[model samples]
Target: MRLLSRPLPAALTIGLVAELLFCWRLTTPHMLVFDEVHYVPAARMLRDLAGPVNIEHPLLGKTLIALGMLIFGDGPLGWRALSTVAATGVVVGVHAMLWQIFRRVRTANIGAVLALLNFTVFIQARIAMLDGFMAAFVVGGLAMLLWAMRSEGGAVWRRWLGGAVLLGLAIGTKWTALPYLGMAGAAFLLVRRRHPDLWPGLPALAGLALLGGAAAATYFATFWPAFLYADQPLTLARLLPFQIDMYHQQTQVLPPHTYQSNWWTWPFDWRPVWYLYEPADGAQRGILMLGNPVVMWGGLVAVIACLIAWARGRDARAGGIALLWIASVAMWALIPKSLGFYYYYYLSSIWLALVIAAAFDHWRDRLRYWDEAFLAASAVLFIHFYPILSAAALRGPQSFHGWMWLKSWI
Candidate 1:
């Protein structure tokens, strides 16, 4: 009973299990999933040091995918290996960050299980996609930030610098994480408000500026390979124009897509993206991106609870998570993009787990094992949907008939 409440042990166990689940049948179907169609080729091009490809997004994610291809020989395994690792890092990072914030084992454990089974991160990691890497590094950056802000007596600056490096990697992976660079500084100030002895004063302004510079430097530095491999020669002068080009591509309108969904629908899991549903290697395989219903739906209550707690008691920890939950989705609404997709909510899905963890942490004495109940429901949904989520074999092409409960999903 006591062991069940220890954070580190559960974190380690959940991290290990998450890695094992992510690794299982990872190379199945032997085909690229959805955006993998775009990113995988770009990764290969980056690996071969050939012409530019998939330039709409930053190069760091594809570069990491390219590194996997370089090491693993540009096959199914190579394309997805690091993505899986990054997703696993997300799982561990979520658990650890929850512990750092709430200092509760049940909260962290529930959050980890919810993250792994949420189906969003699980499928994202299993494919060669930028979201997994972006989510992983941002979570790492935030976790390190929590540590850096709380730590004392030397090495605090080192921790902050480490967090800055990871935040740079996250933004370099995708502009989706760019907002978090600013949000993390805000988190530092919030943490200081909770405990004044830490940073003590208005040093946050200077710290925030330093963090921005460090993260920005690290972000721009990722463009180094482009000079050698891009479609055109890239100079310091050319890079800014190149980024402007990317922003344009990202905002360009396209024909309506079947899987496209709005930002608000994401929290409800109203529409699911079917990344794969083809007969492959003699078995009908399908992969779906859907959030865990328990977490998706339950998180609404947790988020409200967090806001109420913050309003009444100025519970900065819960308030920070509530703000993060809002910011993750609200940022997408503010982005210049003309279209949106369910996968865009992957970051919000992670925040949902965090909010749930915080809510339970806030109500630990009153709520009792509600955390266990939520984790159980999430795990059940994960297993029930495992076949579709993992590209597991189905009887026929019509296999989606059972999984597509909503017309929107169909």
Candidate 2:
């Protein structure tokens, strides 16, 4: 355990475990689940150079999936392998960011553990989707930003450059990462106010402007693949029009579906998407995107406690977690997508998991091992729900109800 007293080693260990879980029976269902039908084909088109497919999303995610196919062959493994790695990258990035913020290996380990157990990241990783890549780059960018805040002149520039690139990649993977720009700007201003002398050589406003410019340049660069499409490949003049089309597609009115949930209900786990359910792999199986009860329910209380600690007790760690959780979740309210799903809260769920870690870290004096205790409870739920969560064989079709406490889950 003493070996994990450092950040890098602990992050490696946690990431290894996460990768194993994500890769376990990775092709179990052997068919597309949920959005994979849309994305996986697009990936194949990219892989074969057939043409543009699923143009509503940006190219980076599909490019990664196509690259995975090139390396792993066009099968379930290829469709999802890159996403699995990307999702595991999020776990490592969260650990790195936690260490930067909390500077405590134990707290960072707790954050990584919660991330591994969190329901949303796990499911997204095992599927072929854009969100996994976007989430990874988003967390990595934030981690780099934290490092940049504490570094010296040249180091600060290098890290900020890295962060800006990652931010661009995040947005390139999915437009959903745009709100993080606002979040990062607000965070930088607050951090500058708190640590006035840290970025000694750079003016705060100038630094923000530089980061934004670098991020935009990098974002525009991500569209080069669009020019490779055979039919009417985009030119410089058409990029803006292409973006306009994508925007309208994203914001266009669409009919409602059963699994769709409002942004407000996402945090509460009011609706869970059944990614897979039916006979498959020789037995009854299911894969439900339900949030863990302990993390989702307990996390709400932890967030309030962390907010109180930030407001009244002047705890910066609690404040950082609270700020990030809000930034990640709150933007969905403003998104024009009428067809929002529970997975839209994927980024916020990671921060809520961190809130649980930060809250226990703050109250360690009286709480003692309460963090470990609750994590144990959450881990038990992880196991209890493993059959459905991991596509493990069930006793029968009715087995899905064994873990379904609410009718809404159906």
C-alpha lDDT of residue 62 in model 2: 89
If scored against the real structure, what TM-score would every candidate get? 0.95, 0.97
Across 1-410, the per-residue lDDT of candidate 2 in tens digits comes to 86688888899999999999999999888778888999888888777666666878888888899899899988888888988899899999989888888889998898889989988888888998898999999999999988887789789878887898899899999999988977887778887898897666667887788779888888888888778877667789988888898998898899979888888888888898999998887998898998888899899999998999989999987978887787678787788896989888888888887898899888889899898998898899888888888787888889887887898998
lDDT of each: 0.85, 0.86
Worst 10 residues of 2 by lDDT: 46-55
Candidate 1: deviation at residue 65, Å? 0.6
Off by over 4 Å in 1: 1-6, 200-202
Q: Kindly report which residue stretches of model 2 are placed more than 4 angstroms away from their true locations once superposed.
A: none
lDDT of 1 by residue, 1-410 (tens): 56557877787788888888898988997987788999998888877778777889999999999999889878899999898889888888998898888777777887888888888888987899899999999999888877776676456777788889899999999998989998888777776666777743337776787689889999999988888864665688888999999998989998998888888888888988889888888999888888878888999999999999899978878988999999888888789887788999998998898899898888888999888887888888889989999989999988788877678777
